[model samples]
Target: MKKKITVILKKNLVNLGSVGSIVKVSSGYAFNYLIPYNFAQLATVGRVRHYNMFLSIKQKKLNEIQSKLQIISQKLNKITKISVKKKIGNNNQIFGSVSDKEIILNLFDITGEKLDKKHLYFPDIKKIGIYNLDITLASDIKLNIKLQILPAFI
Candidate 1:
C-alpha cells in the first residue's frame, strides 16, 4: 500500500481544501499541480503546528463577527413593519414599485446600520399591502422584516 503525502494548503482550492488546511493527496497530483502552483507545501511538524494556531485564531475572529451580526439581527427583529408611502392610482395600484435601494435606506434609518442592498431578498413589489423581506447579514445569518405599503397622503 502506498502512503499518501500530506500537504498544508496555502490557498483555497476547489474540491481540495481551504487555506491553512492540511490534506493528503496523491504524490503525483501534489508534485505536478499543487506544489508547482505554490498552492501548498509539504506538511512538516512546524507547519502543522502553525496551521493549527492559525485555525484557532481564524475561528475566534469568525465567532466575534457572528456575535456582532447576531446582535444586529436581534435589533432588526424588533422592528414590526417598515411603512413606505407611495402614490396610489384609481384601482389602488401604486405608481412605482419598491426597489432594494429604498429598502436599504429605510433599514439604515431604523437600525442605524447600513447594509448592502444586494443582501436583501424580495419579489417584485408593484402593488404591496404587506410583504416580508429577507435580509442576509451573513452566510449563516438571516433576518426577516415586514414591509407595509401605505397610500401617500395628498
Candidate 2:
C-alpha cells in the first residue's frame, strides 16, 4: 500500500479542496504531480505557521467589520420610530408601494450608514400607516424598529 502525505493546495482541483486548504493524498501523487506542477506545497512547520498567521490577520479584519456593523445596528434600534412623508392619493394609497431602496435611503439619511437590500426585511408598503421593520446587520446583530408613514406637506 502507498503512503499518504499532507499538502497545502495552491489552486482548486476537481475532487480536491480549494486553495489554502490542507489535504492528504498519496505520496506518489504529491511528489510527481502536485509539487512538480506548483499546485501544492508540503505542509512544513514554517509553511503551516504562515498559513495560521494569514488566518489570524483575516479574522482580525472580519472582527473589525462586525464591530462597525454592530454599532450601526445599535444606532438604528435606538430610535423609536422613523417618519416618511408621501403624497396621499385617492383612498389614502401612495403613488406606488414603498420599496426596500427607499427604506435604505431613509435609514442612511438618519444614521449615516449604508444599508444593503438583502439585510432589510419588511412588508410591501402601500397605504400610509405604521409598520415594523426588521434589519439584520450581522450574524448576531438584529434590529426591529417602528416605521411611520404620513402625508407629505404639499
Candidate 3:
C-alpha cells in the first residue's frame, strides 16, 4: 500500500486544492516536492485550530459589512426624491449629459454613504425633468427613487 499523508496547502495549486485546504497525498509527493517547495505543511492540530479561528473572524467582518449595507439600504428606501443640479447651455439645454460618477457623488452627499456605479440603472437624462431612478443594492434588495434634473446658471 502506498503511504499517504495529510497536509494543509499553503497556496492554490492547479489540479490539487486551494490554500488552507487539507488534502491527503502520497508520502513521496508530500515529502519530496510539496514540503521541499513550501507548497504545503503538515496538518497539525494547532494549525487547523488557527485556520478555523481565522475563518470565524473573517465571517464576522463580512456580517458587519452586510449589516451596514442593510442600514444604508433602509435609509435610501425612505428617500422619495433626489434632485441634481447641472450647468445649462443655450436653449436651456444641459451643458453636458449626466454621468454615473456624478450621480454617485450626489448620493454620497445626501446619504453620506459610498455607492458603486454598477448598482445604478439610469434613464434618459438629456433634458431637465423628473425621472425614475433604479438602484440595486443586492440580488434581493432593489430601490426605486424619483430623480429630478434641474438647470443651474453655473
**Which predicted model would earn the best lDDT?**
2
Q: lDDT for every model?
A: 0.87, 0.89, 0.87
For model 1, how big is the CA root-mean-square deviation? 3.2
lDDT of 2 at 119: 92
What is candidate 2's lDDT per residue for 51-83, written digit by digit as tens? Answer: 989989999999899889878978887777888
What is the lDDT, from 0 to 100, of the residue 122 in candidate 1? 88
- Is 1 or 2 the stronger prediction by TM-score? 2
For model 3, what is the alpha-carbon lDDT of residue 134? 94
> Tens digit of lDDT per residue, candidate 1, span 1-154?
3467999989999999788778999998889899999999999899899888988998999999889889888889899889888888877788879888888889889899888887899888778499988989898888888899889969
Candidate number that wins on lDDT, 2 or 3: 2
Error of 2 at 72 (Å): 1.3
In angstroms, what RMSD does candidate 3 have relative to the true structure? 3.2
For each candidate in turn, the TM-score is 0.77, 0.78, 0.74
Instruction: Please tell me which model should have the higher TM-score, number 2 or number 3.
Output: 2
